[model samples]
Each structure stands twice: as C-alpha cells, then as structure tokens.
Target chain A: MADVVKFDEHPSDTLRAGANFNLAGIDPASTPGYSGDKGAGESLLSELDGKLTQLQEQLFAESRTGGKKRVLLVLQAMDTAGKGGIVNHVMGQMNPQGVQFKAFKAPTPEEQSYDFLWRIEKEVPAAGMVGVFDRSHYEDVLIHRVHRWADAVELDRRYRAINEFEARQTAAGTKIIKVMLHISRDEQQQRLLARLEDPSKRWKYSGNDLKERAFWDDYMDAYQAAFERTSSEHAPWHVIPANKKWYARIAVQQLLLDALNGLALQWPVPEIDVDMERELVRRS
Target chain B: MADVVKFDEHPSDTLRAGANFNLAGIDPASTPGYSGDKGAGESLLSELDGKLTQLQEQLFAESRTGGKKRVLLVLQAMDTAGKGGIVNHVMGQMNPQGVQFKAFKAPTPEEQSYDFLWRIEKEVPAAGMVGVFDRSHYEDVLIHRVHRWADAVELDRRYRAINEFEARQTAAGTKIIKVMLHISRDEQQQRLLARLEDPSKRWKYSGNDLKERAFWDDYMDAYQAAFERTSSEHAPWHVIPANKKWYARIAVQQLLLDALNGLALQWPVPEIDVDMERELVRRS
Candidate 1:
C-alpha cells in the first residue's frame, strides 16, 4: 500500500483497523506530514490554491455527466477541535459554488425522527463536487456509546450499518475521507480557556462543552472502538494530529489533493456547437 | 426615516411601491452608487473586509443572548445575473460560521407538499447571523408567475403570504434585505454564451437556459408585479443594476454594513461571572 501513488502526506495506514490504529498511541502535537511553520504553511497554501481550484472546477465541470465521482471529506473531531478552521482555511480556498459544507449540529426534532444515516445520505455530495461534513453519522456511535444511549448490540449494528452505507457510496462514485482531528485533553483545556477569555470567542463556549470535557476518557475509548469496528481501505480514517492547527490544515489539503489528483479529471468537452455559440454571442 | 442612519451606498427606495420604483425605468448597465471600475471596486471590497468581518463576529457573538437581532439578505435574480458572485465576493468576506447561504433550487416532492415558506423558515439564520437566500420564496412567484403555474388569485395570495412572512420575521428580530439583481437581457445572452464556451463553466449551462430566455419579457413583467405587490416597509427590495458586476457587489456589501450598523450591536456579556470562569479555566 505504501508503494502506491504518492500523497505528499500519505495518510498513515497505521490508521487502518486491526492494524496499530490506537488513538492513545498517536501524539496529538506531532506534525506527521510537514515540518513547516505558519509562514511556510501559508505560502504552500498559496501555491496549492490554483491547482486545488482547477481540480475542483474540473470535477464540477465533469459532474452530472456519466461516470462522475465526488469526494466527501467527512470531518469528525472533538468540540473546539478546529473543524471550522479547516472549513475556513483549507476548504475556503476552493470555489464556494463547487463545494458543499454541512455542519451537522445536534439533530432537529424532524431529523431525530428519521434513522441516523437517512439525513446523512440526503447530504452526500452530488457527482463532481466536494462535500464536507463537519460532524457526521459517526456521532451516533461515538456520542451514543459514550453516553450509553445505545446498548452493545445496537452499537454493533450501527457500525455495520455505517460500513454498509459507506460501501454503497463508494460503489456509486463517492470517495470518503474520514478525518479525525486528534487533539490532546490538555490542549482542549487550553482551547476552552482561550474561548472563555476572549469575548469574541466566548459565545462559542457552550455549557455543554464543559460537560462534554468531563467525558473525555469515555469519548477517547469510544473513538478507539470506532476505529476497531469501522476503519477500512475503502473509507479509510486519517487520524491527523491537530494540536498545531497549521499542520492539520495542510494535511487535510494534501488529502483532498491526493483524492482529486487520483481521478485523472479532464476539462469537460462542449456538448454544443462552440463555434456557432461563439458566433451567436458575437452577433448579440 | 432617512435621518437615523447612513449607508456608504444606501439602497434606493425607488424600489418601493407608490414611489419611483418601476422595473423598466432602471437601466441594468447603470452603476447606482459606484463610479469605479472592477479594480477600484475590488480595492473597496478589501477595505470593507475587516469592518464586515468584525461586524459579523460581533453579530454572532451578540446572538444567543436575549434580544439579539439577525439579518437575512434575500437575493433574487435572473439566471446568471451574479448571485453567486455576490455570495462569494461580498458575503464570503464575513465569517462563514456566522453567515448561512442557502441556494434554493426547484422544490422537491416533499417540499412541494408544504407551503412555499416551510423549508425557508427552517433555514432562517439564528439571531446574530446573516442569512443569504440565493433564490428565495420569490421564486414561487417569479418562475411560477412567468410560466402561469399559479392562477391570478393564487399568485396574489402567495405575495400576501410572503409579505406576512416578512412581517413575522421582522417581528421576531430578523431584518430582511430583499434584493433584485437586475441584469439586462443582452448581458444574460453574453453570460450564457461565456458559460457554454468555457469548459470549466460548461457544467453550469443548461438547455433550459435557452428555454427561459424566450420568456425574458414575461419574467420582467412578472418581476414588476412582484415588486409592486410585495415590497414592504418591513422588508424593502433593492433593485440593483447588475450589468456592472463590480457595482452590484459593492452595493450589496454596503447594504449589509448598513443593516449591521443599524443594530448598534454590542458584544454580549457573560451570563456567568467572567472572573470566576477564568479562574476555573486557569485551575483546569
């Protein structure tokens, strides 16, 4: 697998299940892909801008035609884990028209009435586009298991259901990149404190965040189990150590580039008579 | 009414009914408040970036506190009239977390089952947020009326329902800025041709675009009636001359700033003691 086509930051297959994919073993502060400072990351980001935009444009251009594949970057992270930052910095660099961002907050009454994957399925990216899910169906397993809302059997069933759901998306034309932005317990505390002190950031500080922090160990355990049950080659999870925000962002950008580059996308051909259309436009 | 506040480019009340507001009199090629080229407009946009970003952050921060108000910039335009451009260039300058952008397409089977405003009401920006509806409930009137999908009475009723809906939203702390991005017929032809010729843009073209062009006069008439019937003091529609895309973008940005300025919004105070929270976070 390592000998395959390169990603500047190839997602570690260590994240692949039944392998050594333990959440605890991975240090949150490590920068796995690049040894760049913020300035270097920003510069690299600038360089990738045109390529990323072009790739996205081609993908959108080809979509709705037959044999189109889309990318769904499913972002799962603990609260205050820079999910929004990635959306702003990395994904923001792309054409907003070509991308879809759905930040799934707590489900609504209407959403709760349906099964978990029902809402998730409705939001899958259309062919030839990039779809981003801030928190995804995995919330069902992670939070539900952490809170003991689901029994072991039901939990096992949901993991199976998630695997089946993702498999179907792949069978059709969706490449799923499930990224877990891994931050340590102490780092999260610093982030929470930062949010509390800054009036601008204070509103984002929810009382539930504090309560959620108390369950940190439980959440970690749930995440470990999730990897054990759900990670696969088809929908592989990349556990990106995210303590340095810049590294997490660059790693995610590389993941998207790898996915898009693998597609061998082409600029779509004109289905209409271009010369005639150009003449008409000239005449008008 | 004009004495209370200022907008760098205040929206024209010529769009208001029983006033000078008439669709045909306004030339689409005219730049209403701007006397600048694209370069100049881009510079102005850059200058406004920090202010807009700050205002949006304050708006979002002020929200969740009681008595907070929100802004909903309802954008209605003819196809290819630069709605997406305004979204990416103007509103995109703000915090994406604080702004909700919903491009309302054709209603689905489930959506058609309910009232036109049902799905709309679901996506209204929470307090302190700025919501952009690319094509809103107005579509039920614009496209529907142009095609005679609804009869005279039904059409009249939908307009009334829309006005009432705006009133309700205004009563509940949502300030509505309804804008019509008015582009000339020839401009549409040019834009459509550009899309057809450019491979990257080809995907955006549709056969229906030509079908729709055939009904241009009818759409113009439909829009005239829509303005006369529905533009209210509670929610005024700004008819922006959009053939000059730069002017349209700047004007929209100014309108948003005016809306935020009118609020006299302050940063929210903490419900709990800030000092205690800081101490607690320090301890943690």
Candidate 2:
C-alpha cells in the first residue's frame, strides 16, 4: 500500500518502510499526475509548449504596447523534496527574455536590516515579465517555526503580513503562482546518498544540510502550519508530488497556461490598410 | 536603400524617403534579424518548443542531484524593444522550480542609499536556482547616462563596480547570460501607436515614454557606451533584433541551449539493484 502522508503530520527523519512505494498506477518513467479525471491524464508536453507559445505571443503583444504584466512564481518545499529538480525542469522551457529568475538567498546585512519583504519586492516581475522565487518570504514561517526563532505573536503578525502583501500584488495586476514540491523521506535519502557518491555532486553536499535533515519532523510541522495559514484562493498552493519530475513540470506548465489563458489578449495588427500599404510601397 | 541610421537615431524619429524595399532572399514574415549569417533566421516560435523540452530534462537532472549551478539572465533594451515580450515568451518555456525572474524597476527609498548593485546582489540566484534580472544594474549605465543622473566620475565608478560584481559572480560559479533586444525606430513608433490606440495598454504608455522616444539618440549613445564597458568574456551580450519577436526568442533560446549543454550533467542512478527493487516492491 502507498504510504499516506499528510502535511500536518510530523516528518519521519529515517526512511520509512512504505515511504519509497510509488502510488498505485504511477509509472516512475511516465508523468505522474492527473487532471480532473484519470483518463484525461494525457501527455501535455506538446500542449504545454503550444499554450506557452500562445501566452508568450500575447505577452509579447503586451510588451510591444508597453503594457507588460509582471509574474511572480514562488516555490516552497522541504529539504530533498525536489525543489531544485522542479525549478530546473519546469523553467527549462521558458524564453529567457520575458522571464527574470531571482533566487533569494540568506539576507545580507543590508537585507536583514530592512523588512524581509524588501529583498523580495525588489525581485518582483516588471510589467510583462515572469519572476520566480525558489524560497520566498514564507521562510519567516517555515524556518522560524522549525527553529522557533519568532514567537507565536510575531509569527502570527508575519502570516497576516504575507497575506496582505500578496493581496496587494494581486491588486496590482501581478499574477502570483506558488508551488510546494513534496517528496518522501525515503526518496530524499536516495538522492542525498547519490549526491555523496558522485564527485561532481559531492560539492553540493554539506554537513549542515545533513544536520538539517536530522530535524525533518520539526521542519515538516513548520511547513504544515505555514501552509495551512497561508494557502488562499488568491494564492493557492499546488502540492506537487515530486518523486516524478516530468509530471511536476507538466503540471506547472498547465497551471501557468490556465492562468495566462484567462488574460484574454489580442495580437496587434499594423494599422495600415491596403491603400496605405500600396501608397507606402509606391512612395518607397 | 536601407537607411543608414546611427545608434542614436530612433526608427520613429527618422523619416526616410524610400520605396517599400524587400531585400533579396529575406523573408519579411520571418522574424527580423541581421545575424550577418545567411541561414537559420527563423523566429523563436519555430524552435521554442524543442529547446524547452531539452532544457527541462537537464534542469530535472540538476535539481534532483542538488547541483548548485545558478543561471542568471540579464536583458537590456531600448523602449519597445520587446524586453517584456522576451520575458513573457522565453520564460514560457522553462520549469518554474529552477527559474526565478526579477525585473529591477525604480528603486525604493531604502534601495537608493546603497550602491545601485546592492539591491541586485540580494536577488542573485542561490545554489541550483536560475535568476533573471530585467533592466538590471545595467540601468546605472543606460538610464543614468541618458538622464545624466551620475556625473562622469560617478558613472565611471559605477562601471567598475559592475565589472567587478559580474566577475566575482562568474568566479563563484554563476553563469551570467545577457541579451540586448534591438528594435528599429519605425517599429517602435508602430508599437507605441498600438499602445495609444488600445485602452488596456494605455496604462503602460506614459507621456515620458514619448518624451524618451524623442531622445532616441541620447538613449542609443547611453546603450552603446554601456554595452562596450560591460560586455565581457564572463558575461558577453548577445544583441538580438527585436523587429521580429519570434527571431529574438529563437536567438535567446539557442544561447540557453548552448550554455546548458556546456554543463554536461548526468542523472543520478539508484544504487540498489533490480533484485532490491523487486524485493522492496514485494515487501510493499
């Protein structure tokens, strides 16, 4: 039987017996997601490409008219939960122009001094641009919850702050897309061990990462609380099962397409008529 | 004959007396670009899908293995040069997990105090994340030059800071990809007019945009100077023609593929053998 995991439950630090088991009907090699119906789980790689292309064209039209729309994508997940893979694979399909990727790291002295959202707001997408944040402002809740760095009152205040901040963005006509990549502990161990074994990848493995891995239960609890408090209709969280990378990417593509499709954009045609074209041609 | 316009000249600002001339072997419908090469001038739409898939797979591998390569995309361009379109269209191809897009707009009060690069530094890609900066620190050179916001000494100081900043990033294993979208003055006028006619795009059309358009020469001078100073082996600029949006996207896509192909990463394999898998399956 598949290991049923809930966000609220404490994470198991050790690899559990059933944690590695694939869900029924899930193929490790094939995509691992279903839309509304199981039978409709068709290959969307092509459709994703087509939809993205159309969206790009629509957005391109917007930019040509200088009416650019900003897109902010936020990805929050647990350690070894395929956040990295999801970023790599999912964004591999984007055109470099319309997209600007900003990964917010540990706050420098300057960043820490200001509000946490200061650094994040700086990286928000400009008009007609898409911005993705690998780990976003929610860190106050996630890391703070696990480490107890912030008191309950402070944390509560932050939760409200985040909701208000995102709401402001939504009002500003910015599209907010958030995803949480979820992976099993057993799968994570397999990945961690693989990184240790490979010389090239060994550089990525740090003792600190392992140390954090030991506190998986605390982190999971933090994540659960953060998600419960933060998830909303304005910024719905897509809990992606990331053991399968292809499916996660396809799902993201679909989500983006759905959002972009709602925009209802028209391409600009040159204002010149047949007579104008002829006259311009004749003059030329 | 094609007008011999200088860098400082805007396509709209210059009114040329000429017949509608279609250069031989040039497909007007094809994305407009002067690669100076006779072949492979197709727009981004033609090749966007294929490259998106290839990159997605690579990103998945890198993310799964916890590789720490960060991809930073920098786009610079004149007004209506398709920067927004490029961001929208190009990013349409990649996975969201690995990519985070940032557009640097007018700095806030807090941002203005520090060096211009300070806000940008905070948004740099983390290990294994892709960061895109739209109208990034280069604005110090581009906009500052046109507006004369910085005296010669301050501008000179800013240039050195930028060079050092990018070099340090490259040394620290950041891959910086810079693209400049080039659009003609005629094309700019056509696009601007479209924005004025469209109510939805009116929000993006500012009186200043028109005023800025009038100072095309100054902007070009600023851009040329900026490009010459900052284009380096570590972060070379690929000048993309923006007349054909499709072509611009294609050029950027090719650049991404080339950069990623250089990494040559392998997907991690499970250490457990088939027998172990079978046993695990049976146990489950």
Candidate 3:
C-alpha cells in the first residue's frame, strides 16, 4: 500500500546519470522530486519504512535459498555533506542484520601495498544483503586526482578499473546505487561552525577539516572528473542536493526504495513440506 | 528525562546472574521489572529510544578520541524465541554506524578448524561500538552438549575458555551483556504454527526446527549448565522472559542502557583550538 504513494517526479530518473552533468547547475537546497513540505516528507518516510523493511527481509530470505542478488549503495561526498546523516536516517531504518555498512578511511600501509580496490573487495556484502560504503573506491580517483597523486595516464587507468569493477559487480547480481551528496561551500562552513560552537559536537571538528575547506574548488573539479569517467549505464551516479538535511534523507530513501522495488522481490518458497511440519509441530 | 523514569525493579538486577538459577522458576509470560501494561511499555520504549541513541553516540564519539570503552550484547535463544525481533526493535533504534551485528550459524569447515573463540574474537566491537551477537560461541557448549558431540572434559574446557576470553575483553574495556531469551514450549509451537500458515513467513520455517523441538528438555539442561559454568562478574547472563515480545525488547533495551550509563561516558575534548577554527570557518 505504501508503495502506491507516489512522488510528483521520480528521483531515480531526475537524479541519475553523470554524462555531461554540470555541478553548478544543481541547487543543493532544492527538493527536486518531492512535492510536499518537511512534515509531509517526514510522514511519507515513516510510511515507506514498513515497505522497505519487508522488501529487505524478502531479500535476506532469498539469500538463504541460494539467491545471489544483493544491493550496494556507494556514497561519495565531501566533508559535512551529510553522508553520515543519510546513513543514520535512511539506511538505519532497515534491519541492521540485513545491512552491511563500511566506512573507508585513508589506506593503511598494508592497504597501500595492494591495488586500491583490494581492501574494498574484502568488505562487499554477501548474498541478500544491502551493502553501504560511506566513502568507497571513488576516493582513489577523487582525492588522488585533487592532489595529483597519479598522473593523467594512471588516473585514467584507475577510472577504467572502477568502471570495470562496478560492471563485474552488476554482472554478479549486485545492484550498485552510486550517490554523490552535493553540498555548497557555504553550507559546509555553517556545518563546521555549528560543530565548533556545540561542545557535544566539537569532537567532530578538526583542524584538518578547515584545511580541507581551502581546496573547495579543486575538490569540485575532481568530483566532476571522476563522475565523467566512471558513471555508466550499469551504475549511474545520482547527485543528491544535500544542503537541506531532510530533503537529502528522503531523496536517498526514495532511491533505495526504487532499487529494492526494481528487484521485484518476493518471499522465497518454503523448502520444507508445510503440512508435515505443521503436523509435527502440533504433535510436539 | 527518560532515564529518570524508573522500573519497579531494575531488570539489570532482577534478570542478572545465573548462579543457582532455575530456568523453570521464571514465568515466560510475566513482565519482570516493568510495571506497565503493554500500551504503557510501548510508550516508555519510544521514550527510551532518544536516550539510547544519545548514549550510543557518546560512546562512538569517545572512540574517535582513543576511548576504548564499548558494549557487546550476546543474544542466545531457541527457535522463534525472537532473537531477530530484539535486534530489529531494540538495536535497530540506534545508528547502524555504531552498531556491529553478527549472527553465528553452524560453523564452516574453516571455522570449525579454529578454536571456538577465534571466530568470535574477530567480530568483537571496536572502540565506541555496540556489538551484538545473534548466536555466539555458546553454541559450542549448548548444541554440542545437547547432541553429546563433546564429552564432559571438552565441555568443561570450553566453559573455561569462554570465561577467560570474556575477562580479557572486559580488561580491554568491553562491557559484555549476555542474554538468553526464554520462551515456553507452547509459545514456540504457536510461533512455528504462525510461520507455517503465513506464506510471507514460511521461508523462516524448516523441518529441522521441528526436529530440534523434540530435544527441548535436553537443550534446557545444556543452557543451564552453560549459565552455571560461564556467567561471571564481568560477563553475566540475563535470562529474559520473551513470550511477550514487548517486554523482552524493553528489558533488553534497559540492560543496554544500564551498561552504557554505567560507563559514565562523556564527550571527548575537542583537539583543535575552538576560536581559531571558528574564525577560519567564518573566513571560509
């Protein structure tokens, strides 16, 4: 019943695709597909929660019966673009048992010794799971390009490697939902200041965060380059305007809903004889 | 404010410790500690959600600054006793980013090759995480003892190994909450029947479940033996009456809240110069 509640515009279509996409054209504060105000958005989200939970359970059940299909949500964003908020509000609504969440930090010495995707390959969600990457293999291209850690040839090679990697995942029954949470520099400053002002939030503030703010333009360019190279038909990037935290949360929730719905998931058939089991249970 | 709302008796005290514990003495249908009716209990649980979320966030924040304190909830129960429900309703309320959930099944050949504690040690909560085990190393004792897979000597060795492993974890600042969700045989039958009749829930039913039910008394004995030998000051086993799903959920939530509250967690001091960072953010 909740799935019948429709948006004026489907976020999946409006938000998807990165080819010839311009970062400046999108407004971070706008709610694109959702028509309602904050209260309605929140209400619809609560309604959608039940549907999402059921779909996820079906997926997990399917996995138990040798279903290989799973979902991987790849989140790439700058500092304070509300990636954690999305994880908390959207992905957090699902059963934690069915969700595999991994936050990738800078590579360690051992990780640096291997290809960038080696550590990532280790954390992929198994059959019937919804895997979430807080910051994923995209960083190898985004951050590396910003700092010129790799030459154009190597950067280009990394982009090809990423596309190939994602294609392989899609071929193996993984539906990859790649998202870029787009937030403005002004919004980042405001968020950072809020973190600095509140003692409870101060722990999140760091000197490096401010230092990173100085490279705002360079990071934007890096993101655009990465998008142009890696976004493909199998795994298109969805640029979510994340300045309004509520809007971003709802939009991402919609994207996940669509992904799960696209799977047309149904509960797996019971492997046992129901009549015999029922009789046995009754006698016992 | 929610924490100020008190139970008639603290579940932490009422349900804790297994010394001379009688599994049959506790009524599965009775609501222990909580004095409220179902409606009131559900309301109180909704209220407690905020408190639990804040406490978990503080634990996670502490970990960012080298705080080693963490909590591990180990849930063990019979089939259809609601281990998954507790995880969905209780642990599901917290941010998934801070919750580490692992469900143990029959060990694979690789897992069986290692010491029983080896697989468990790998899944322990890192600093500032709330780790949950759906079923854990206790299976080595419970299932093994019930089926006579191991003799008295090996079972005794395993109990000691589990105790020592938990002691080391506590020494390293992990607070372990071990819970056994106790349900009546009649309740399990009703639950299995409901699963058998509902097509949506049929995937959860297996013929093996009915087979396991025949050994109910043996499983009970094995559980009691596990509690006597393994429960300790650092890691105590709390047997929760789970016939009423609401009571079991809130009682477990209270146990987790008490564990986190006992830690006396505080937000870590900001490592950067606050005024300087604020001014820099303003400039940016």
Residue-level lDDT of model 1, residues B186-255, one tens digit each, is 9998898889767678777776777787788999999889888888888887888899897788788888
In candidate 3, what are the lDDT values of residues A108-197, reduced to their tens digit? Answer: 999999999899999888999999999999888888888889889999889999999999999989999999999988899899989988
What are the runs in model 1 whose C-alpha is more than 4 Å off? A1-8, A11-18, A66-68, A106-119, A126-129, A278-284, B1-8, B12-18, B62-68, B106-129, B147-154
Per-residue alpha-carbon lDDT of candidate 3 for residues B1-284, written as tens digits (9 for 90 to 100): 12333479989999976578888788999987777777777777888999999999999999999999999999999999999999999999899999999999999999999988899999999999999999999999998999999999999999999999999999999999999999999999999999989989999998888888899999999988988998898899999999999889889999999999999999999667787777878988
Clashing pairs in 1: B14-B21
Q: In the order shown, what is each candidate's alpha-carbon RMSD?
A: 5.1, 11.1, 2.2
Predictions ranked by DockQ, top down? 3, 1, 2
Q: After superposition, how far is residue A278 of candidate 3 from its true place, in Å?
A: 0.9
Error of 2 at A260 (Å): 8.6
lDDT of 1 by residue, A190-253 (tens): 9988988887788777767777878999999998988888887788888888898977887788
TM-score for each of the candidates:
0.86, 0.56, 0.97
2 or 3, which is superior by DockQ?
3
Relative to the unseen true structure, what is the C-alpha lDDT of residue A68 in candidate 3, on a scale of 0 to 100? 92
Those runs of model 2 whose alpha carbons end farther than 4 Å from true positions after fitting are A1-284, B1-68, B263-284
Q: What docking tier does model 3 reach?
A: high
Per-residue lDDT value at A6 in model 2: 18
In terms of lDDT, model 3 sits at: 0.90
- Candidate 2 C-alpha lDDT tens digits along A1-284: 22222122211111111323322223323333342222233244544565675575567557566564666778877665666665555555556555566666667999989987888888787777666777889888888777888889999998899999999898887888777666666666676666666644554454455556667778767766666676666775655566666555656666677667666766655343534433332332
The residue-level lDDT of candidate 2 at B169 comes to 93
